[model samples]
Target: MHDPHSERMSSTEQRAAAGLAAVFAFRMLGMFMVLPVLATYGQDLAGATPLLIGLAIGAYGLTQAALQIPFGMLSDRIGRLPVIYFGLLVFAFGAGLAACADSIWGVIAGRVLQGAGAISAAVMALLSDLTREQHRTKAMATIGMSIGLSFAVAMVVGPLLTRAFGLAGLFWATAAMALLGILIVAVLVPRPPRALATREAGVAPQALGPTLRHPDLLRLDFGIAALHAILMASFVALPLALVEQGGLPKEEHWWVYLSALLVGFFAMIPFIIYGEKKRQMKRMLLGAVSVLLLCELFFWQFGGSLRALVIGNVVFFAAFNLLEASLPSLISKVAPAGGKGTAMGVYSTSQFLGAALGGLLGGWLFQQGGVDAVFLGCALLAALWLAFAATMREPPYVTSLRLALSPAALQEPGLVERLKAVPGVADAVVVAEEAAVYVKVDKLQVDRTTLERLVEPAPAC
Candidate 1:
């Protein structure tokens, strides 16, 4: 039977969760603060062109995507905090370099360096070490919330900062934030035990092959890539549109983003509730994707009018936020037992790759045909993603569990088969080297007592 009292997160877990969430928030805030104003203000740099400016905006993603997994693996060898410390210092140095740059290419180089400081996987590994398995979902959710909040704050703050202090000032502020993040991690976060640090938190090289080839996982990965591509591409044109076509003054752009994000956030709540509580995730996903497609089309067709642009943005963010929240949950539900870390690593890489491509494509299209071309291109990408999403199977509603195994139990043959034979147990993977069983089970139908007894079998009479 489940113990209700065991569900509460311990004080140590709470501190670790809060500290790590703040670390993630600071880093994300630095990255995102440049997104809203770069298209407009970046033009003032020497040798700036439509394509180069687009590259400047998205250059970090290229390095980030390529190095994210490697950094995580590095942490496994050296320890998580050392990797984190090095990543933050590299990020700060990159931001300082951007702050001092005089040309668009210099800025791009700085952004590339910023992305080289990839620490997302390392941070997640540390979080896994700090919290028990049962409490991990809550810890991860906290970090997710922090990222979402930072993005919202960035949308409003980016323009205001640029207006106050110019493009270089924004990069300077980002450097300061990265430094602050280092301090937070050093002071607030505890070091994980050596044994727990190397646990299931880090990626397993052996799991990567199967994780990459998973069809459903591939679809979701493509969906994220497309979503980010559309985002980066739209921003390449959006700031310019707001000033020229929409007649929104440069200084007042923050209000539009503030209002749109607020409306979109409130609008997303009902769909989230309907999707999760009612188990209508596939329907919710399809509906959100359909809504995203229409909004892109709306941008392409009517973006010239300020009213239409504002309305389109409000709706766009509504769908974007929904899809952003839903995709990770779906990945978790679909991942093979003991393989989620690898699955998520690949998904994140695809997402960054999409951002890099989106920037390049958006810039080229805009140069060829202006704002209309960019929106049209995004619409086409959205349509392609919609087609892929339509074919995804309804994901299983199962929870993953990890249980330790005794030495004697490890010697028993057919242990995995026996666990899978239990009612409501969906899948089981027994990694003998780790002396652990990773299980997937339907909570409603699964008998906890039976599951527990099977994992730690009683001594023979």
Candidate 2:
């Protein structure tokens, strides 16, 4: 018999994880490639203004926020691949439109269309369908890492690519990359064994209200919104400052981004290790937010010096990366038993909305009071976030688990209670329809063998 507790991912599972991660990387890289260069090159476009440039930068988030849940639901109805294909095609079309556009308004229209694709949910659902319960978390983490890597790479690559090909050329590259993503999904990803009735990873409609209403979850949602808002707003000003005030040529912006991202990524690792190992997540989170607020102030005061810009950026990203990595893990921990998917959905929507608002506000501030106003505005946002984060209690340090149930065990009326009684299982939810139990367990204390034995059927007599 196969070991239920085995951590080894099957070869097929490896292929699925790798293929999906690539899809995520390609799509994210495409979207993020414009971030560092747009504020500078975008000015040359017809009808360009700081406000319009910001709108163009953030327009995609509005569409992505609106459509992601619906697309996830649609994938359940029709099929995962169909939804994925459609989203990618739409994204490609949008990129092509932006690539050919001569005006900022047209670019904004293209960005909205790009976000309309909203394939993230479908891609995740497909991953859930393909992977075994034992290794699903690992698979999801792989995809998450790919996304973060893509964002960092985009920061460094955006400037180089923009200098070589201009803003329109960058859009064209994204369009090509989207098309490449479609091919990767078709050729490389393995088909699932069957379509399961319950998607443990996909959003659960009934859980949405509770997920949103939970006070801690609400704090997390607000935190992500503030985080992304700050990111979008800051980008709107950073490029402009580097070129206009810091006396750095636009083409050389890549080295600054490259150096800062490398420093930030390495600096963030130890904080994550300490926070998780020591269970000091709340303290870590609060500290990161405080540092973010200070970074904005640093920019507001001494941004004209190129040296200060580099140092401030490196520090800002370290905090930003730490918070970005922590928030989702915190969401998984704080979400109600069996409501993780819904909680994440709400959190994602909040994040995108924050990004949209950030771009708009950042542009408006820059227009009104130059880059200094943009930094000041971001500082105020960071301060508000720090206040909100300060009230959050420590998150329960538990890992989420999904266990497949035997047919006989599925008939047990007290399944949830029995599972809950197991040592180290903090919470349990049995989805009888799916013949599975989702549990949050404290690994250090959990008796895995006993829990599995209880869930397994009795031997034949």
Candidate 3:
């Protein structure tokens, strides 16, 4: 019998979840900590063009985007811990290299290496291995919230750390954090249960094609890409604008970041509630995009005033938070049966690619014109994204459920049809090799008794 909501994680599961979330914090904060101070400190590096500086900020994303899927797939071949250990080593080395870097290009190279340590998919897969199915969502949510908190902390900490110890010191600190992460994985995280060896917790090559082909998923992918790119590009110009135009000192940048983030987080609460309670996610998404566009327009027009800068950031952060929180939910709702991981993998890739491009373009525009050019570039991207978002239809009000089946049931004639014929099952995918059925069901219309019988054991002769 499925426990559903009654499920409680074991002690081992809770420890594994928290430890893994810490690993994500270390990795993500390392990347995010440089965003606030890079434009200013990077100016001193050799051959530093605004474009090259921007690339250094976002280079990690490019490499991360390229490698995450393959890295996850590789973890399936080797043990998850070994792959993670190796990735952490790579990340630490990258951070150390950046710490010693003398040129913008060198920093860019180090950032690329930092991204090459792609371990997110592997980490999530390991989390799945360590938890029960009913508890997996909670475990994942823990990690998700950890990543969000890490970003917030980084925004506040980055400027202060850079002021105290320079850019290299920040990189060195990140290297140390990576080593700490390695220790966490080794000592605190438990090995996966034996069932994980053959489980479909990691990516399957077959799921890639269908996930890519889905038009609705493609729109969300593009949406994430645009969002991150604009975010990266905005920051490229934002810090310098606050310093030069707004007259805020570099050390005080944390005030802007912390305040904006706090405001945005609170401001987004109602929208999130509405998104869930009213099922108006599509409306919320479009509104958020429009808010982003308007924020960029404001920055472009009145970026010089300190007050205007604060207002722009607060509004920008609010929209950013809303979209960030909404996107994964939208992806979950839209992905086809048995293909959510694959869909998310593509979505993550899109996001990183956006970051890389956004940084590079923002820099180029700044070089060609000035701070205003970067704002204009961001505005243009937001406009296009808003249009793309307009085309997205409301997602189905269905939930995906996984059911384990006996092999005999897999071979039974009309099994797929029988599952589909169950009230409110819109789609059924039976992966015969896995002896499982992945069903998309509208719970409001589904008959619970009929659904329960599909997964019941066969009667003895």
lDDT leader:
2
Query: In lDDT terms, how accurate is model 1?
Result: 0.88
The candidate 2 region of ten consecutive residues with least summed lDDT is 192-201
- Comparison by TM-score, 1 against 3, better one: 1
* TM-score for each predicted model, relative to the true structure: 0.97, 0.97, 0.95
| lDDT (10s digit) by residue, model 2, range 195-230 | 553535778888887886799999999999999999
Order of the predicted models by TM-score, top scorer first: 2, 1, 3
What are the clashing pairs of model 2? none
Give model 2 RMSD, 1 decimal: 1.5
TM-score of 1: 0.97
lDDT of 3 by residue, 1-461 (tens): 43544557788889999999999999899989999999888999999989999999889998999998899888877868888998998999999999999999889999999999999989988997887665776888899888888888999999989999999999999999999999999999998854252223556678888888898999999999999999899988999999999999988999999999999999999999998778899999999999999999999998888899999999999999899888988887888888777887898899999999989998999999888999998999999998988998998767766676776677777777887877788887877776777777887888445665776557779
Q: Output the lDDT of residue 5, model 1.
A: 35
